[model samples]
Target: MHQTSSRLLRMTDDERPFTRSYIWPQYALLFAYPHRTSLFISDPNNSCDFKDLFSTLMVSLPLTPHRVRFRMIDFTFTSDEAITNLGSLKFSQSNRMPDPKDSSRVVTTTTTTTFSMAKEMARSVCQKFFEAKFIESVESKIDFQNKNSVWQLTPKGIHILERFCSRNGIQSAHVKAVIDSSRNPRQLVILERDIDTDKLHHDEQTVEIIFRRFVGATVNESLSADSDSIHEFSRSDVGVRMIKHKPSNARPYEHVFTGKATVDWLMDCCTMVDRREGLEIGQLFLDLRLITPVDARAPGNDTKFVPTKQAQYYVTVHGQQIAGWTEFDDSPIPADPNSGKSREGAARDSNSNRTNVIIRNPSWRLLYREFLKDTMCEENLSFYLEVQEFRAQYTAAVSITGDHKIETIRETLAAAYGLYNAFLAPGSPNELNIDHALRTQLATRMTRAVGDDTAMMQSLVEVALLFEKAQNSIFKLMSSDSVPKFIKHPKYGPQLRGLDAAAAAAYVANSNMSSSRSS
Candidate 1:
């Protein structure tokens, strides 16, 4: 809590001589009427938990201290007017109201009571502000026109309110509500400390950052820890040790985390944040009520503090450990394209020219060309062109290695059928116009562009052979005498009539089986 000065303002002539009757009327009228600022206060204690809204304000607020002041005016309505207004207003507690039929009793007492009630309410607000240490002091002055005492924020109070308003991106009206203790904190606490970058260490105290962008849309609740608990994608080699914690509070840690080896491996994928830093981040989140302790009976249940795919997060430690973000934007550093690869003079064995040619060819472009006359269609052609361009761009940019190369070749094979299907479509294009010679040309260019990777080369050759076999089977079936029946019949209709129903089925089955085995 921040320390504040205790300089009290002396009451003015009109403000003095306060009594229970004067306070009750004011309190009742204020309570009975609704104010926009009051909506921000969910609890009477002036403590709040506004959820994500509060977090947003904390992040966007300016750190530099500043000051702002506003003069509070007396209630627009007179005591009698407030009492009269209260007749039509609702009260939470019916007992707070007096009999309306007794006009004499109401006139003599209710006017002071209404004003007094409002005064008490203001005093309560002042008390809340003092408790929260939100103000240095409050002052009062007589309004020259009305001789009514008005409250105002002292310099310290103004500075604090201004800072809060700036950080929260709220207007002066909202700031006034906060100063009056009409608004509470949305969360348990808002941590404004600057994260220390010196605490960062790699390897032992760090984890390799791994970022994944999902292909489709995702929701906050669906990506939450409760939906799918965080765990390592792979196991670690490090030996296990007993976790140091008491039994009653240990189940959550035990259930959420895995073995030491696996934990290390999982952490390796996260950006490095040491244990001490992790503790600080965790404490901040805990104080803000972002995360609560896991229940003993139902572990890994709903979590407010856990970072879902929806929330930005820094690398964490242990189970649900929070830590500093890698960058100001909170984005993870991308994995280097050259990571783990031999750079400059590092020795790497060379493959034969023959294998090199196959890699460059990938031969999938050849396969696409071969099947183009049989399958080209708008959708197929569009996708085929996109994949082709992507592969070309990727090959030209980097030295092919590991999964990157393998994935490219895999994509080639995956979309290879589109060309075949397009060529065989109802309004098929001319087969003669499509060049067959480009197969070798495409393979050569691709191989040169992709450079060399053993796994990628092998995958390319394998898929090429399969594509070749497919084209051959397709051509053979199209040219055979059985083709006339295939052409005469509807797409899904009968063919190979020499054999009866059973024989035809058996023959077709055998052909498919042979084709599958060959591929």
Candidate 2:
């Protein structure tokens, strides 16, 4: 390769300019450090001649091993009129006095200038280069209204190059900070994005989550009390609508009624949909009471049935199975027993299919329990049963839709249970077992119920204190290993306390306590 500058001449081992015959896999370095924030642009004051800019870029390339190869090159040139109107690029000049050893005595001066280009136009140029392989494929784009074109590198390209460079020990200090920052994981906050359309219905269900954000440290106050005195809260702030993507929400909710098989198979059995596997699941929700067709079946009415709202769940056989529908006439449809079609044409009417069974606010306890049951085994049998019972009682006591303090307590308890079982449990699974719908619902509900950070923290602290008290009380009786064993033994008990120490020792010896303990 011919070098026009000394910088280009100092290329390390396999580093070379873009060439048709260059072996990309064999080379362990890239042209620039690829990042989302940084972009390459030409000097605004310079002429738009592509050849001159390209040459300058090669010569000015920082002495650093790049983690990502150049994806595309952008050449942006402002019109003469625009340049004249915007004025010459902003610049600064520095003067250097001539030294005594210099014979020519010419004062050296240097200029630094900031360039401006139309970013959209630059992106277009980069796109063309990417398509032609003049550079690599297009990774991403940055939208800017100002006059500047930027060509950014792709993350995959950067990662591949980084791994290659690491293997070769070609570390570059210039890109070290960028690499480290990119490697660090980001803090996650629970949020929901609202959408007006059911565009993603095929992929997953969209569930609404309700939560409140506070402006200050009154989170505890907000959570403990009502949010009536608004701090500029909006309907948007109250809740966010999020789509529950598949498999994440598609984990089979196990039920004894669904037989020993998964809820997926049970759904298949119930629905005639083309993709029957997970199709019916969207229509089937957890009913805590294990309400059957007989339980819900009306005495004289054959077509319409409305059981007690307590512990109820609604799953639609058609459309998205969420709430928000016009109230249906609870009375049975007047139908001919022979034909089974309604005389009022209600069966044919689209409105007749609407039912009240779909609950807008499902029991949080049941929803979480059914979801978590997928990960449990015999070891957590007691916990599983406790969750099942807790859900049943919770649904029976609380209305489906309301902002009662009791509801907030239920949400907090559910979150606490999830944290303990899925996160803090011994031999717990590493990944979060929660589905998108449940997460969105629970997060919003808890946020709304608690009020703010301080309120939520206070609620959690109270729960923790209660749990600690309960644990101390329960363990007091069985805290020592020897006490419970002695109480249970038929030969020793409270009655033995009245006997002398000699008699107790004799009894212990006769019962073969040492042998029993060893066994």
Top candidate when judged by lDDT against the true structure: 1
Instruction: Report how far off residue 132 is in candidate 1 (Å).
Output: 4.1
Off by over 4 Å in 2: 1-125, 128-158, 167-169, 183-519
Write candidate 1's Cα lDDT for 1-519 as tens digits. Answer: 011111111222233211100001111122112221121111111121111111122222222222224543321222222222322222121111122333223211111111112444434433333222222222222221221222233222333444334322234443444444522222111111111112322221112111110000111122122222222121112211122332353442222222222222222221121223333443343344323444423443333233332332221232122111122333544543542232211212111111122112222122222233234322232222333433443343344566545544433432232232223212222121223444333223222222334544554454345344434434333333222332344521221111122223333454568789999
Model 1 stretches astray by more than 4 angstroms = 1-118, 127-321, 324-332, 335-519
Q: Name the 10 consecutive residues with the lowest summed lDDT in model 2.
A: 21-30
Candidate 1 residue-wise lDDT at 187: 17
Clashes of each: 33, 17
How does candidate 2 fare on TM-score? 0.16
Model 2: number of backbone collisions: 17
Write down the lDDT that model 1 would get. Answer: 0.27
